[model samples]
Target chain A: MYFGGSFSRGDFLFLLSGAVTTLSITLVAVVIGTVLGVLFGLIRAGAPWWIGNTLGAVLDVFRSVPLLIQLVLFNSFNSMLKLNWPTFTVGCICLGIYASAFCTEIVRSGVGAVPQTTRRAARSLGLTWRQELTSITLPIATRIVFPSWIGLTLGVMKDTALVLWIGIVELLRSSQIVTSRVQEPLLILGITGLIYFVMSFPIARLGNQLEKKWGTQ
Target chain B: MDYEFQWRPVLRSLPEMLWGALQTIEIAGLAMMLGTVLAIFLALAKRSGKKYLSLPADMWIETARNTPALFQIYMLYFGLGSLGLQVGSYTALLLGITFNNAGYLAETFRGGFAAVPETQTRAARSLGLGAVQTQWHIVIPQMLRAVFHAMTNQMVWSVLMSSLGVIVGLTTDLTGVTQKLNVVTYRTFEYFFVAACLYYLISKAFTLSARVVAWRLFRY
Candidate 1:
């Protein structure tokens, strides 16, 4: 005599909707995160000692703490302020900024990988700082940083699953809901895990392949 | 005039939270140690060139790599429970972190093993050593040395994942304790903020100590 085994078609659709929400959140967050990260990365790279470290200390908090705690803290702060933003809005905002903290480091490292001699030579050739960044630095750094950026995108997708803690019905939460009614956790959770695997595995393999191809050249 | 924060509740329960942080470290340390042991076998299985050995290893590694940690925790706590195997919350959380650690460290070890030159294995095999003995003596040590930095990274990730114990119904861990406090006090910001700071401090301590250890060990 086993447990309740009533996983319906509607339950599967619910999980897919959750996966869709997860993808949307990742897309928005990456857009917001990568832009802020590039801007912050450039500043961190070019700025002086005092300013950069000061900025770093603030962003380090995001990198250090678990995403769950960050989500809870941000949600709490949101409610405390009486703004009453939708949970989805709050989730996207929190995840976007959380990703920026990591993206800043990636982009800064990307910028740092551009050889000083190369930058100096760009300057020595009468290119302004802006031109050097646009022409000499950005192009090379993009090639070096492309694979890492893809990894970050995948990371943000997985991290989006944490948004369910703040009451969003993302993939994990949706599966949890179905499992509650269906009484088959392994089946439901296995399907949820497969959804994430299907979503992530291709991108991860691409990143690895790109890393290998670019690394040798 | 709203949101007058109360820090007294958090202040009063500082001892409890501190204890919770200690448990967090305990989980992370235990998971990293056990995970490293598991990762060695998984890595070897992955490279064993035998279908039966490598296939399961590949599945474990890939499944763990692809899914969210929260889902993995759910699978252990709820999924396995449905199968009539009752794992305690703490045990589930511990195993979940260990599972994650082993999955990632397996990949790192595979790369590290590859980087060990074939001649070293040949030299060991020539010295009247069997295959397993050669791996244990020469190959594993070199692999560990090469992947030491990556292992330190996985150690810190184990710390971060320890925060998930609370969600899995273990109330003795840092995040769980903090959430418990918040449920009573309704001062979500205060309790979670403190928890967040503690997490940051723990991770920083891990990386700093790892750097010092590397400095000491790799000075040559």
Candidate 2:
């Protein structure tokens, strides 16, 4: 009896479109998050003490605050500042910013996990700081932190659902709209959950595979 | 740009904000207590050798971990209502938060179980203790230590996530009141700043309490 009165093919399509939007947002956010995370990690790991401390404080504040609050704050701020950025853009920025905090710590830990000997060897080869980081440090660190990084990436994808609360029309929001019409909450939720699982399952499996392959090395 | 900072609106809303903070703590405490009990069962079930016992537990953990807590709350609150269950928003919110908390807490306890040395468990068994007795007396104490920090981390997360219950129309929680104030006063910074401070204080208090408990429990 689920989806009984008001179900239609269009509702399924809307849900599918919502999944697409979620995926797109996650993809963009993850890309931005990883790049910024690496930059912040490098700064924290190798920069001057003042620079490192500033980035460290930023990470702490960002990580401590809830993502929901950050999203809402950013959305309101965007309007207040007259930035005229789309809600989706604000959603992506907030997500990327939030994810980057965790990612920075992950990347910093990876960088720290690299041995002092390696750094010394790179310096002995007359490589500059940037050169040594690119050639020696990051490669090893990436391998070392692949598991946790992948875990954080999956976390980002899941956290994107929060954007729906701000009216982003992501999967859950789409499902809510459909459920309101169809009056079959369980079935709608089950379907929406299945959609999320389908999206998340492959990433998680890939993460596991990466962890198994690189974690031991 | 001419911007005036308004303190009066925020001041007027302070009492409601305080009430919201109380509600936030109430939801968090209830959810954490329920979650801890559920987590113990989940940890045990996952560690159980039988597939029948372990598979469902594993599925629950994976699903909860992979999806957003927001979606889970929506599914419970709005999705359930659309199914004709007719539960109140607060009941739905609590159920959703407890379910998600149990999922994460299960992982924490599982980590603790993994950290418990097998030799200790074996020593207890050789002393003629049954599985339950060995678990209760020998394994659990050690496991609790390993899990303590992780549980504290989960508590902080649960407090933050409880904010999402506002979307489901639970008007008593901190996030709920913030949303209401934001709509009415259009004072984003003032309202969110207050809410943020409240959350920060609560999380700090939780962290300090956990530290005290860990010191007393571990004694080293």
Candidate 3:
């Protein structure tokens, strides 16, 4: 009967909802991460001497450890500190923090790639440091970093699966539930893999196109 | 409320954790070696210009890249088991990682291959070197050197990814052993912290050695 029975309509809907949850979590984390990443990027690249160096060193710890460990540690931190937030909030926080570290590096390098002559030109034209960064450095840097940003987006989407470790029941967890109930692990997992492929392929191909286009300029 | 930090349990379990770290390295090293070999064939298949070879290679790379490594491992371990094909946890983890690594590395190698200009291939042919001989003697070496740093990054990835083995009831690796220890003693912070440190140390060691190796091999 395990092999004989096919998935019901409800099963398909449950899996689709899981996909929605996965996308939602990824979307929120990307927004939070991008904002925090830009702030940290500016701090590392533009702030005063000790501040920048210290922030860089601190973020390196996040970069070095695995995200799974980061999730567990964050859970412990939440419990120990008695914050008692929901698991989804904790998942979003951990992923946001994780993405911030990498994005900080991405942003810093993107900004760094801007030529010094361009910055000086802005300065000579009476632009303040803030104006220079916003009008001149950031626009050029953003184009340079767009391709890497696409790669990062794809990465964070896939990594949302790890949140299932803390029992958030996203796409992968949904499939696991179905497989356990149906005794059809291969079919469930195959469908899950296909879903992820559908989601990520276009982004990756777009990144390639962007790289070629931006690379020429 | 003050949450007092304790260190003794973590200290006492240091040896077990160290052994776990060794197993982590063992799995990652083996996967990298296996994956790199498979990746060369994959890269060649993509470059072969035949529809069958290139299409399959592209599919594998896209599937491996697009999906989470966890999905790949689950399909191999649980999915296969349900389909009546049982593999041990270690083999499943290794194969999953190798599949992922080979896919990513195949792309990295393709970039490296492209970096070697077409004129070089033409020159090799003009010099009467056979195709295999040309690739073996010239293209592969340059490709290795060009992509050496990317390979090092992938090696670090494999090590970190080995931590996912804990999900599949793998008990021998660092994260698995840490989880088991966490169960016995609820010193979650201390044990996980130590495991993180071990991972960081392993990655640092690999990265440092990679630089030295790069300097030596690529000096020409």
Clashing pairs in 1: none
Q: For this target, which candidate reaches the highest TM-score against the unseen true structure?
A: 3
> Local distance difference test, per candidate?
0.91, 0.86, 0.91
* TM-score of each model, paired residue for residue: 0.95, 0.94, 0.97
Candidate with best lDDT = 1
Model 2 chain A: worst 10 consecutive residues (lDDT sum)? A1-10
* Higher-scoring candidate on lDDT, 2 or 3: 3
In model 2, pairs of residues that clash are: A185-B82, A185-B83
CAPRI quality of model 2? medium
TM-score of predicted structure 2 = 0.94
Higher-DockQ candidate of 2 and 3: 3
Predicted candidate 3 versus true structure: per-residue lDDT over A1-217, tens digit per residue: 3453677787878898999999999998898889999999988877897998899878877777788998999998888899999989999989998889889989999988999899999999999998998999999999999898889889999999999998899999999888767777888888888888889998899999989987987
**What is the DockQ of the complex in model 3?**
0.77
Two-chain DockQ for model 1 = 0.77
Per-residue accuracy of model 2 over A1-217 as CA lDDT, tens digit each: 5545877899899999999999899889988899899989988988899999899987777776778888878987887788989999999999998888888989999999999998999999899988998889999998888888878887888888899867898888888788778877788788988988887778788887988777665
Task: Give the per-residue Cα lDDT of candidate 1 at A68.
Answer: 91
Better-scoring candidate (TM-score), 2 or 3: 3
